[model samples]
Target: MGNRLSKIYTRTGDDGTTGLGDGSRVGKDSARVSAYGTVDEANSCIGLVLASELPDDVRALLVAVQHQLFDLGGELCIPGHAAIFEADIERLEAQLDAFNEPLPPLKDFILPGGGEAAARCHIARTVVRRAERETVNLARHDAVRPEAVRYLNRLSDLLFVLARVLARASGHGEVLWNHERRKA
Candidate 1:
C-alpha cells in the first residue's frame, strides 16, 4: 500500500495530470484515468444505495463491495499491480447465488424504477456496467489484470440481482418494460 495521505490538496494535478502509485503521471483524460474515475463513480452510487434502508445482510455485502472497489482503485493507481484478489470475485459470486436463488427468473426486460433503495441500486448497476466497459477499454491499452475485467462484469450482474431483491423486499415489483404497449 502507498503512504497514507496527509494532505487532501496536493495541487500537483493543477496541470490536469494525476500521479499514479508507481510515481508515474498521466493525463486526466487518459484511458487509465477514465477507468479509475468510472469506478469511483460506481462506488459513489453504491454509497447512495447504502444510505437507504436495507436488509442487514445486503448492507454488509455492499460495505464489503465498497472496500473491494477501493482495492480496485488502488490497483488502478499502480500499474502492473494486482491488488484485487480472487476471493473478492468469489464473494460476489456467492452473494449473487444467495440473492438470486429465491427471486423469480426474468422473462422480460425491466425498467429501472422501483422503491427508493431498489431504484438507487438500479442506477448503481448501470454505473457498474459503465465502469466495466471503461475498465475493458483501459485494459486494451494498458497492462491490467484479466481478473479485474472479469470481476467488474460479475459485479454488474450482482448489482442487477440485488436491485431486484431490494424491490421485492420493499413490497414493490419489477418494472417490466412494455415494448408492445409503447409501440402501440
Candidate 2:
C-alpha cells in the first residue's frame, strides 16, 4: 500500500490495455473494465450526493459506502478476488432497515424526483443496479464472488432508502406516483 499509484498516467494503457492487480493486462473494453467502470460511476454519483448538505450520520454512512465501492471496484479489477466482504453487505442491510423503518408503507410506485440530494441518491441507486448487472454478466464468463453482486443489489436498496430519508429530512415528502391519474 506504499504509494501504489505514484504516477497517474502509466501510458501502459495507451494501447487500449490496462493492468490488473494480478499483474495481468487486458483490453480496456473488457468485461472486467466495464464492471469496474460501472462501480466507479456509482461511487462518483454517491460523491455528488455527498456534496449536498446532509445529516452527519448519513454523511458518515455514505463516506463508508464510497470506500466499500472502491473495494468492490478492486475486486472487479482482479477477477476471482473477494475484496468486498459479507460485512459490507450486512452494513448496507442494516442501514436499509434503519432508514426505511419510519417511512410509511409504499402502496404505490414512487417517482425518483425529490430534493436535490435525494434525486442524486436515486441516480446513484440506478447506477448501482447497472453495476450489479454488469458484474453478473462478467461473472457468467469468469469467477466472481456472489457476494459482490449481492452487495450491489443491497446497496441499490440502501440508496433508495437513503434517498427517501434525505427527502424526509429535507422536509420534502416522498414523491408518490399517481398511476391512475393522467398528466394534464
Give the candidate number with the greatest TM-score: 1
Q: Summarize candidate 2's per-residue lDDT along 1-184 as a digit string, tens digits.
A: 6988788987888999998978999998888889999999999999999999899999999999999999999999986677888887887898889888988887987789788989999999999999999999999988899999999999999998888898888888789988778866
The C-alpha stretches of model 1 lying farther than 4 A from their native spots are 1-3
Whole-model Cα lDDT of every candidate shown, in order: 0.90, 0.91
lDDT of 1: 0.90
Q: What is the TM-score of each candidate against the true structure?
A: 0.95, 0.94
lDDT of candidate 1 over 38-88, digit per residue (tens): 888999999999999999999999999998888898887799889787887
Clashing pairs in model 1, backbone N/Cα/C closer than 3 A:
none
